[model samples]
Target: MPSSNDSRVERARIVASFGRQFYVRTLDAPGPDRVAVTRGKRTDFCVGDEVTIRLIGADQAVIERGLSRRSELIRSDRYNVKRLAANVDQAAIVIASDPRFSEELLLRMLLACATAEIPALILANKSDLATAWAAIAPRLQVYRDLGYPVIELAARDHPQETRAALSRYLTGHNTILLGESGMGKSTLVNTLVPGAALATREISAALCAGRHTTTFSKWFDLPSETAPSGAIVDSPGFQTFGLAHVSDSQRVHAMPEYTELIGGCRFHNCSHIQEPGCAIRAALESGAIDPIRYLLFSRLAGRD
Candidate 1:
């Protein structure tokens, strides 16, 4: 403990972060940066986690310290607090034909990202069932209109099309792919991982839901050829996500489509609920917005 040398000290900046585990290289050089660091991290760390290192040798370093984040994405945990997924550039909400799209669940996810100002994308998968996509599109228009870049695809059918649509948001950014069971999130993960196979479940037409396969969130690196610079985390699909941490207004702000009507609302305190003279209400009454979505937003926004 009495080493009074620079050999005991090391410092570097975080460039690509995925929760507690992050990849860091040396500050001055390139070619994979000659190093990687991780130090018993249990919470969140992102691309910008400023860290002090414990020098092990010329060949290795350990993250002994971390700086706080400028912003973060988090969802409610059991103890009445939001758990963080630090350094995520965007949250990709995946939806498929069966286990049918839960707009309520979707809104909660969208609000979670919006609370932190993180961009959100809606990936509508399972295009082999074009009829299913058509049936679901009207329900999804809320999220689309709200400004999430909606991507339509089938997990197995068109690799080139899927790659082209998703490649842009994912470049050099750590994104989380999340949705309910049977939504082909695992299929998507399988696509991203080179020679790695993640199990996927099928849907029950009578019940209209997918059998659960994943029990907890796990990380996976995308194929270097497809996502060369950064990686993606395919989180365990959830039945519901808590939105108590973010307000209704903040949720609306996270939604891109609502950008125009946000400040246009008559009342600064508008909940878009029973408030009179509300622009959102006007849109709702005129069928400019989906009622199912409005209902979900009201219920979740009530948490504030």
Candidate 2:
């Protein structure tokens, strides 16, 4: 804790955020993390944000303002835009073989990452479930063909293999884990960061919420031996991920397979939905593009 009279503005990184309350670690000095709050109703801050703060007490501070973000992941519906995290180097979209993951939600997350210009990889968890793994293997191959690295691992059943497979991607990067509920993301986080459960408990105590009430995002520093110079953010699992913030043109260009064929449409402003001379439709018909992905595009573009 800093002296109350020392009113110097210092740099800090937000480690946890629960609604308007935040926990920030000082980047400028060695001290315990301070409880932080904004001066007004500005609740746009998210975990992993680098911000400036001024200490008001020994254990609390006021967030002055945020620094420039390197990257930000956001999801939006017609009513609201939710910021997930900021300053993330990459994102890992965790999906499971069992429980039948939604391809629509997965595609929306990928597009959100693409629109944010952040690199993303797919983690096909639950590979130990042989029957389910066999069923989802081919669908996972489609993403691999599109150039997204898809790593298969069983986070709970094979912790060693899971850690080994994710080490290369997690090392030296600030990664955010994105997944729908029951995808083993929490297990993965505990496997990667042994202290994650404890941290979660601490956060729960601080917020006076139940242990299972994951209403906030929390950041964990990776063990040096496992992933030096790296950190991971565990976000609340959600059933829906919207992309109302993404424009129609942005969505089209975000698809890797559609980029090359974007300007080949007859009309310069082709919607790629029903235009007769649309190159995307031609590619879909010729099997150059995955039909599932094409259909997903139509649905996301509100054409379906």
RMSD of each: 7.2, 2.0
lDDT (Cα, tens digit) per residue for candidate 2, span 217-240: 888888888888899998888988
* Top lDDT hit: 2
lDDT, candidate 1, 1-304, per-residue tens:
5344525645555543433444454443442322445756444544444566665545456677766665566776445564445556777889887657777777778777777777888899986887777788776665656556888877777767777677777778777777787788867777666544422221122224344465434344466667766667666567768766765557877655456676878788877778878888888788877677677667765563
Every candidate's lDDT: 0.65, 0.88
lDDT of 2 at 220: 82
